[model samples]
Structure formats: C-alpha cells, structure tokens
Target chain A: MNHSVRAVDRIAPRRQGNWDWRAAGNFVAGGAGGGVLACVAALSIGLGFDPRLLLAVGLAMMGFGLTCVWFEIGRPWRAMNVFRHVGSSWMTREAYVALFAMGTGLLAIGLGTRPLVAATGLLGLLFIYAQARILAANKGIPAWRHGRCLPVVLSTGLAEGAGLVACAGAWAAWWRYPAMLLVPLCAWRVIAWRRYLAALAADGAPVGTLTAFRRINSLFVWGGNLVPVVLAGVAVLADAPILAVLAGMLTVAAGWQMKYSLVCRAAFTQGFALPKQPVRGNSRTGPGVKPGWQWNRWLTD
Target chain B: MKRYAMVIDLRRCVGCQTCTAACKSANATPTGVQWRRVLDLESGEFPDVRRSFVPVACMHCANPPCEEVCPTTATKKRADGLVTIDYDICIGCANCIMACPYDARSIIHQPQYAYGDQPIASEAARMDSQHIGVATKCTFCKDRIDLAERTGQIPGRDPEVTPACVNSCISGAMHFGDILDSDSNVSRLLAENESFRMHEELGTAPAVHYILDRR
Candidate 1:
C-alpha cells in the first residue's frame, strides 16, 4: 500500500482550468451535428415510418442521452429525485422537457398523427436547445458564455432536423425541398465553426500555462474545427447523400474531440515568482562534503 | 418555504476535511466518495506565498444547471432550496454531470457497503444499495430536516436539526440559514462581510456565499 501510494504520488500533475466556452461550443456542435445525422437516417427510412417506430427511436435516443448523464453523475439512483425540483432546478426543467419531448414523439408515432409529430419535433428541438442553454449558463466557462452559442445551437438543431426530414424526403423521392433546407444548415455549421475557432484562438490561452493553451488550440482548433470544415465542404460539393451523411458523422466525432479537449485541458494556475539564488562559497569541495572557504575571500570579493 | 444556504469563511477553514468526513458519515457516502471536499489552492510564490482552503459542496443554487439538462425529470429542488435526486426514475444518464461547473455531482455505478459486522438486515442493506447508477449530491441533510420537523424542531430555529457540516465546524466558519430571511445569521454575515460566490459571473444565483480572508 505504501509503495502504491508512493507510486501514485510520483505521477505528474496536469494543468487545471475552466474551458466552459469550448465545451459549450462543442456540445452545440454535437447536438446539432448528431441531430442532423439522425434526421438524415430517419428520412432515408422513408417518411412513412410507423409513428410507433419513430417514437420508439426518439425515446431510445432520449434514454441513451439520459444514460450519458447518469454515467457522469456522482449518484445515479438519486437522479430520479432531482425532478422534484422542476420548478427551480434547471436540471429538473431539462429532464421534464426531455421526458415530455420523448413522450410526445412516441405518441405521435403511435397515432400516426402529423400534428403530434410536428409538436413532438418542435419540443425535441427545444430539448436540445435547453441542453445547450444549461452549459451556456455557466459564465465561469468562457467558451460557453457567449450569446451566439444559444442561437448557434438552435440553428444546428434546425439544420439537423431539416437533414432528418430530408433523408425521409429522399426515400420518398421528395428530395428537392429538404435539400434546400440542408444547404443552409450545412452553411450555418461552417460559419459557426469559423466563429468558434476565432474565439478559441483569441482567448484560449488561460492565465498562466502556455502549454495547455497551445494544446487546446492545436487539438480543438485544428482537429475539431478545421478538419470538419474541410470534410463538410467536400460533402457539399459532392452533392451526394452518402457524402453528406459521412460528413455529418465526421462532424459529430470532431465535436466530441472538441469536448474532450476542452474538458481535459482548460485549467487555472496560481501565479508566483521564483526565489532569488543564494550566494556560493569560492572554494570548491568534494561531492559528498560541504565547501569550506576563507572569510577573507568574501571581503576581497 | 425554507431557503437553506451555507456561508464559509475561507480565513478560518483549516482544510482539515472534518466537515467533509462529517458530511460523508451523515450522508453515508461511499468510500473514496466525498460529499464535501476541501481544495488546496496556492497562489503567488516563494516569499509571497499564499495558500487558501476552499471547502466545497452543493451550492443548492436558485437556478441549478443539473436540473436543466436532465432528460428524465429525475433531479429536482425542494421548496427549501435543497437540490436532491430521485433514484428510482433515473436512467443512469450523465447529462447533469456535464452541465455542472463545480463538478459537485457524481454517478454511482457500483453499490458500496460497510465491511464490518452487519448491524442492519441484508434486505435493508440491499434496498439501500439499489440506489447505484443514479446521480447523487449533497441534500443538505433533507432526511435530518424531515426528522426534525416531524419532531417539532425545524432547522435554523432549532440547533438540533442543523446540518452536520455546520454543527461540526470547529472555527465557527460554516454558517447555514435562510438566505431569503433578512435577519438570518447568513444574511447578517453577508451584510457585514465582503462576501462572494464561487462563480458569480455564471449567474446561476448560487445560495452559498464565501467570506475571504482579508488579512
């Protein structure tokens, strides 16, 4: 146990800081990006999907999202009780919205009702937005503190929703309209990525450590932001559904990477100056012994 | 409608983690898990050395981010401003964990148990253990509050029902009361001291306040 403790103590410490904006930005990107992919997949299955099936899928996604949340929490079983604070807790509000949205989506599917689906879809969009807003509310995280993040996330949701609708349209051979929506959504994604990148480049560096900031810029700014932009452009030009879907997939991966970089890298360090060096004796000594020098040497110097 | 809040004077908080230990025991938090934590924050350098102990727990904010990101409506706040979790409905989702800025929440994926002789029945222990995989946080001892209220002893008004952390504070640095009440000890202290929240800029309207060491 002592040896293990010593070993653990020897491990190098990493930088600690807040990367709220970056995390929020990436979350927006993921929700919007993943939403688009899901929409595309739904469309590809044909708009005639059984309302039940659609509801099931949507609910499943919500459940999966919940699992992610639970995994991140300190106590999973206690999570249910959080809803008790729905009136005051943003978490409760988000949870209620998610549950309501899933239920609505499920009901619409079960009834094969267009109005219900639309309502559910709208609620779903809001659910995603609520997730974004939750992160954006944290001003301590500079990356997530901007007004633009909320709008950007909302737009991403729209784009992704449109893409899903388009996939359904494609299967139904009703491609023209959904494609029109996808074009703008893809464009918005590009613009948002650019803006996020610019912000990160300008302010990514935390107060003290240069290494962590550089890592953030290189990993997130380049890998997450740049790669996705290039891939998205190629997909747009290809004008192929497969290409678009592939680009969307890459975008999600990049977004996750961005999130990881933000979480692992951002930190705050206390600043301090080094102490002055002490004067040394003039006389040289053996490796094992202290140096001995005459007092006269100090006087002469 | 009780409004519970904690005031921590950073000056006298020795970071002994007694409050943390007391919170864990009161809450029965698992080993290697902490309901309250003390952070050792060092600033400046060498001759200008400054070290501060930051003891943290759930802020029980007026607007909690964890509540906003839950998809299953599992996490909630009480009328008394205590943020709590319901184990039964939780789907093991970690959305709230990502949403919290303070990292106050933890997801229990595995059951924890006492190693000594079983004082409580196995069934009861199993029932308690079933709360695994749900999000957990400091409840400000809601169970204690409930017990006290039932016995005609409301916390803040009665010393017996006060939170374990507040009662165990040796330096009188930890204060708990209603932030809404004008004459409450917490409010009076805030009025007299230069107080600040951990992340006031976030605007989550945290109820927990801090008084830093001016000296």
Candidate 2:
C-alpha cells in the first residue's frame, strides 16, 4: 500500500491540513441523521403516518455530529463565524441548513404536521448536498474534489438512512418499504465508489492514494456494499424481521466506514509540483520533483 | 494595475539558505512553521548528478485558491496582489491551508519558541497570541511595504522597504519589482530572460518566476 516514494524533508506536504476524524464523524452522523429524517418524512407524508424513531434518532445523530465538529475547531469561541460565509463557503451553508432541518423537523414532529415533516425532509436533503460540496470545494485534495464524490456521499447517506428505517421497521411493519430500497441504494453506492477510484487512478493522482484505496477496496466493496445487500436479501426471503434489523445495522456501519476512510485515510493533499527540472552542464533534463507524496518512498526505495 | 512579482535567478543562487534564516527572523514564526523555504533537489544518477536550490514561499497568484476557499473571507488578495489572512475573523478551520496548492498557508496550533517554553525578549515582543489557531503565510513583508508607501519610498528599490528574503540574499539571486511597470527591473528581466513559474498549468498565475540557468 506504500505507493509513494519518500525523499528528504526539505519540502512540506499540503495534505497535513484538513478535516480530521471530527470532521469525518460529523459527515457520517449528520448525513445519517438528515437521511433518516428525510426517509421518515417521506413515509409520514406518503402513508399518512410517521415513525417516532425517525424523528428522535435523526435529530440526535445530527446534533451529535455538529457537536463533534464543534470540539474539533481550534478556536471554540469563534465557532459562530461558520455562519458568516453562507454566500461563498459550503461549510457555512451546511451549518445553516442543518439548523433549518433541525428546527423544522422538531416543529413537524411536535405538531404532528405532515406538510412540515415534508419540508424538513427536503431541507435535510439540502443539508446532505451542502456537506458533499464542503468536501468537494477542497480543491487541494484530488480524491475529494472528483465529481463522483458528491453522488457517492449523497447516495451513501440515503442508503444508511434507508437501512436505519428498515432496522426500525422490524418493530413497525410500515418501515419495510424503505428497507427494500437498501439493495438498490447499495448497488448505486458501489458503482459510484468504483467509478471514483478508477477516475483517481486514471488522472495520475498520487500512487500512494491509489494503493491505499486498492488495499481497502475489498472492505468497501464486500463489507460495505455486498454484505448489506446479501443480508437485506436474506431478511426479505426468509421473512425474518430480526435479520432485517441486522442488515440495517450492517448497512449503517458500512456507510460510516466509507465516509471515515474517505475523509481521514483516503484524503491526501495535492503536494508541490515543479513543472520543469533545473538542468546543469550537458545532462538531459530530469523529471520534475514531487516532495509531498513521494518523500517517504524516495528516501527508502 | 501594479502586479508585484519576484524573480529568482537560479544561476546566482548558492543554496546558502540565508533567505530561509532571514525570513524566520523577520516573521518570528513558530518552531515548526516556516513562511519561506529553500528546497535542495538532486537530479540524475550518482556520477552525473546536479543539485539545484529552489526558494519557495507564497506565490501570491492572481487567481488565488486560498482566497476562493476561505469560509470567512479571511484570506484576501489585495490590489497589489498580496494574499493575507485576517486573523481576527479566521475560525482556524484550515480550509485555506488545504486549498492552497503551494503549501503556503499554515495553521498555528499553539505557541512554541526556538529554544523552549520561555522565549527571549525580542521573540516575546514578536509573538502574537492572537495569531495562534489561524491560517498564516508569507505576507511578503506587507508591513514594511505599507510603511515605505506612506513614507514615499519605492517598495522593491528601497532596501528597508523590500521583503526580508530579498534584502538578505547575498548573491542577489532574488529580485522584486512591479511586473506591470515597463521601467521596473523584474519586467525587464521577464522580457529578456527565459523564465517560468511553478505549476503554471494549474492556472494559478504565480507571481514568483524562476530564471533558468544557461551556464
């Protein structure tokens, strides 16, 4: 998995700066929270009923994610400034949307209003979109900046939310319909994830990143996507409600794993690049130096 | 309309790292933080190898990615083409640090001195606690340039008004001037010599140019 070459430490890497575990956790928790709310809202509006679990769990997850991000900031007192950049920064917009989603969702659940629940669900989707953009806007990280990142993130959130609904559906029969969507959702996620990795390799991004994803490919593909699909299939075929709940839990866990690796492990910065090499005497021009990703490999290899 | 730029002559540079030392002292940077750096690159096979020193800092691009991704609009590019971060408003999210392709911006997590916990008097005077936990980079000595402008002195020409790295370069490898001005030294060099910017294909339009060595 060590695809990069290391050299001397004269030049620094840009990837050192970014959203760490707290940020990754925030995406997972918030996406799951909003996704759950959206699913519940749809169920309530379409079926003239809502699951209480969706309302409570969704908001709780979103709140937990926000709290994690809050703790991650170096300056806690200046946290409120996250709202100042709504016009430009996706992070700001995500914050505002999260607030709106929470407020409207709470009101919808408190008042037992179907229309309000629908609006909250729509806002929740918007919140997920904002989170996707927040990562994509980081142009330095080639893996995160690819076009597939948005769809992959959004679909995983939807799938995780659906899985949650299916798991909760074990108690309530009405939750089974959303659970059925998990297989297709997982399929979409796997496709998108594969496409993104291929694109990264094709674009000649850091070899280390390629190797890292390759090493973890089986986990993401089989553990995250395939396993959930099989479990959900078995739950449906065997008519076992308990098995359905297990499938839902597995799907949710897989979604979290995908995001955790994407934000923390797969995330690498576009290090410094020299377009032309400095020449001396009559020697042929040498290859340009890339210090950020290759430094370690250059030293050892 | 005045686009200030720096042109470093690769032939004249001796890889002394005097510019790195001068920049550290001038900025009073933290222990791990360096606003300017000299990278020594060794190319070719053992017997035929050649060494080149590349002095790097913030390129002050015309289209700056750092400013584009700043959540709080804290990283701003002035009309003179210098990119600066407003520490008071910065939330220390480190977004700009990731956005910058140059590896220019740094987030100071905590206070650290050259020696240890207790800093000397001069170091203590320069240490701004407020700067901690915010994105910071080379300002190209904006304070000195501002003072020179107010005092009716040319920025690149005046020894006291220029960047510390440019002033400290003993081999005269680094030259600073307004590229847009036809009469400026950098403009003349840019027109005459074969020069190139780093990662020009990225469309950053870096203000720093390197004059390739013919000898």
Candidate 3:
C-alpha cells in the first residue's frame, strides 16, 4: 500500500484528565446498586399486608433515591429548577412520573382502591422503564448504550421489587401469586444477567471508569444470578416463604452489583476520524504542498 | 415569531468563564445554581494537548423531552421559541433534573444573596428564608429584556431586549438573535460555519449551535 508516512503518524494519543473516574464510579455504583436495593425494598414492602401501604412505603423509598441523584449534581438544591427546561428535559419527565406514581400509590392505599393500586403499579412500571431509558439515552456513556438490556434490567428490577413485596404479602394472606410471579422475575433477572455479560464480552470493555467490570460481572453471575435462581427454586419446591425472602435478598444484592458494574465500566470516546494524507509523488498535492518536498515529510520519510 | 438562539464561536473563546460569571450575576443565581457551565474537555497527550471548552446551557429544543413528561405543564415553550418555566406551577419534583443531558437545571432550596449581603446581615437572614424552596435558573435575563423593551430603552433602536450574557460577552464569541431572521447574527454564523447542536441524535433539536474549537 502506498500510504504516506504522514498518514501513519497522524494518529495522536488521546488524553483524558483523570477520566472523571471517581464521579463516574460513584454514579454507576449508586445508580445501579442503589436502584437494585430500592427495587428489593419496594417489592418486600408491596408484598406485606395492605399492598397499598407497602406501595406507598416503596414509593417513598424511591423519593429517597431521588436524593441520591441530587447528591450527584454539583448543586442539589437547584435540582428543582430542572423543570425550567421541562420542554426539553428527560429528568423532568422522570420526576413527574415518579411523583405521579407516588401520589397514585398513596391514594390507592388511603382510599383502599384495588383498581387504583393496579393502575399506579402499571405507571410505576413505566416510571422505572423511563429511568432505564433515561440512562440509555446518554450517548456519551458507552455502557448505557445497550438498548436491549435496558428494558430487561428494568423489568427484572420491577419483578424484584414485586417479589420482595410478595414475600411480605404472603405473610398477610396465603396467596401464592406473588411467589409465582417471582418465578418469571427470577427468569428475567437471569436473562438480563446473560445479556449484560454478553454485551461486556462482545464490547471487550465494560462501559465507564471501573476497569474491573468483567470481574464484578462474574461475581454477579455467581452471587446474583446463580444463587437467587437456585434459592428461589428451592423455596418454591419447599413451599417456604422464608426461603423465598432469603433468595430475594440475594437477588437484590447481586442486581445492585450488576448495576454498579454497568455504570462504572462505561467508556466514552470521540467518534471523528482523523484527516488523511495524500501519497507522495502523486499530483494531488497541487496547492498546499511544495513540489519535491511533501508536507509532513518529517513523519513520512 | 422570533426564535431566540445562540451561536458560540468556540475557536475564539478563551474559556475565561466570563460568560458563566455574567450569567450568574445577571440571573441572581443562588450558591449552587449555575445556568451556564464550561466543560474543559482535554484531548491528546501532554506534548500534543488540545482542550475544548463546551459552555452549555438550556438548549431550548423544538421538541423538548421535559415538557412531554411534566405532569403540571409548568414548563412550556413560547411561540417565540424560548422555553420558560412557570415557577408557580413547579412542584419541586426533579423529573426535569434527571432528564437533562447537559445537566443544565437546578432546584433552589436556599436564599440567594448578592455581593453586599453578608451572613450576619439582618436583611440577608430575612431574604434567605423568603426565597428558600424555589426552583430557579437563567430566564435569559427575561426581566431585564422585558423592562428594556417595555420602556423603549433598548440599544441602537433595536426593539428587542438583548440577554445580559450576550451583552457582557467580551470575546463576541456568544451571538444571540432571532434564528428565524435570515440576516440575524446567529443565522449568518450558522450559514458560515460547520456548526452542530449538542446531542443532536436524541432528537431534542436544541436551538444552541456550537462551532467546536477543534485544534
């Protein structure tokens, strides 16, 4: 190939200042890890007697999670003004949705309306979905780009939320539906775990600042993925709600690790291609270069 | 209707953060509120260092995601193409906060003080408690613009009131005008340079255009 030496030397080393490593790590760990724990807490609360009351408690926990998000910002107080750009802000939408979900859940509990609870539950699901979408929307973060994994993770989180609640609900009433729901939630968690690992493997790099995402992912597979599945299966076979609760806690912990790994390992890179140099002795360097002395000769020859 | 927009010539911008300061002063933004921020993105190795300052604010997109999600309809884009929030209707819910890609918005939980007000000042304590718990940001100095236009005191016989940040810009890097007008400075810059909007792929269609200082 008649490539100019200038072309070969054009690849410059890109520099990143400390890579916002701490902030990035904290963001991923807090967002994903906290999210999973919150989900588990919500599920456990929801399963308790008076699902509506539990839903309210779960929603309030979500509100606390919002505070964690604010802590990530340089100015937590100014978080309110975010509505100023509501016409163009996704965070605003997420906030409104969360508030609505919380309000509806509260109303359902206060008024003792099952229909309202179901409706709010559906909206809460959407709220969680939007949360995932918001993260995925960040093109700058490569780890969040997995479109497929987003919904899967969100649904799994929702299921985990419901499973925790179901375990509590079983104590109130001998309804096995919540436990049965755990079966699919567990399945979704596995699917999401597989997809996440596959994505990490395919990309050859975990997104963000955590260089050890793959290792963390392996831990999640063993702890979150395998343990939860086996325990839940055992709980189902044994007809033991206590065993189920234990398994659910394991699932939640593992999910948190998975979320942390996702955010911490994401990487962002500039997508522009560098300019190319013309081959020497070619007539194409008509105006810019001097004859018999090629531009970037120091690099070329 | 005039669609207000800003064109930043990053090549000429020294990254002095003069505009950021000017914006803070003009808007009377609180301690943690930053309507404008300069992101110093450093690329290339030490010997071949290249840094670009991306000063970001609200993009004022045509199809704003925040509006779509706002339950209170507190945020609305005016017919003139400026996105404004009705603070009275805002419920302090941080939905818009989470949705912003540029991290442009902030909620005000404390009182904002000017240069004269000290912590022990009697007026400071009173004023502090009054403005506490309100969401605030740059209205493009909307009050000043409105006052200037209403009083017919605008410079050069131009009927429109110019934003304070644009007026205080020393480098002339920030140009704001009606993007709808073909002869406007923002339009002219867009015609002349390879300007690009931030996060264009998200389909927010932000009004602000940046001429990147690619070294």
Best by DockQ: 2
Locate the minimum summed-lDDT window of 10 residues in model 3 chain A: A285-294
Model 3, A175-254: lDDT tens digits are: 35455556677677677756664654554321222244445656666676567667667766787777677766666666
- Fnat per model, in the order given? 0.15, 0.44, 0.01
Best by TM-score: 2
lDDT (10s digit) by residue, model 1, range A1-301: 0111111110112233222443344344435433643453344344454445534555565566555555455444566665664544455666777777667666666676666666665666667676667656544344454555565555556555554444443444444445554556656755775565455445432322234334444444344434544544554466555544444444444444444544445432211111211111222111110011111121122
lDDT string, candidate 2, A1-301, tens digits: 1122244443534345457889888899999988888788877677766655578798889899999888777687888887876767888888899888878888877887877788888887887888898888876677777787899999888888888888877777565566577889889989988887766665556555655677667887898888888878887777777777877888788889878878887777676555555554554444556654432232122
Ten residues in sequence with the least summed lDDT for candidate 2 chain A: A292-301
The candidates' DockQ values read 0.12, 0.50, 0.07
- Please state the CAPRI-style docking class of candidate 3: incorrect
Error at A192, model 3, angstroms = 2.2
lDDT string for model 2 (B1-215, tens) is 67789999875778899998999999888778899988776654656455667888899998887777777877888998888888899988887776666777777777888787898788788988877988889999999878876897877799888999999999998999888899998988878776789867667889999977443
Residue-by-residue lDDT tens digits, candidate 3, B1-215: 56778788766666678888888666656665678866554433445334445566777778765555554566677776667777656655544543444455567654555454455354343443323443345565566546754686642124246776677678777888778888887887888765677657667788888764222
* Residue ranges of candidate 3 with Cα displaced over 4 Å: A1-146, A169-181, A193-216, A237-242, A252-301, B112-131, B147-160, B212-215
Of all true interface contacts, what fraction is found in model 2? 0.44
Candidate 2 docking classification: medium
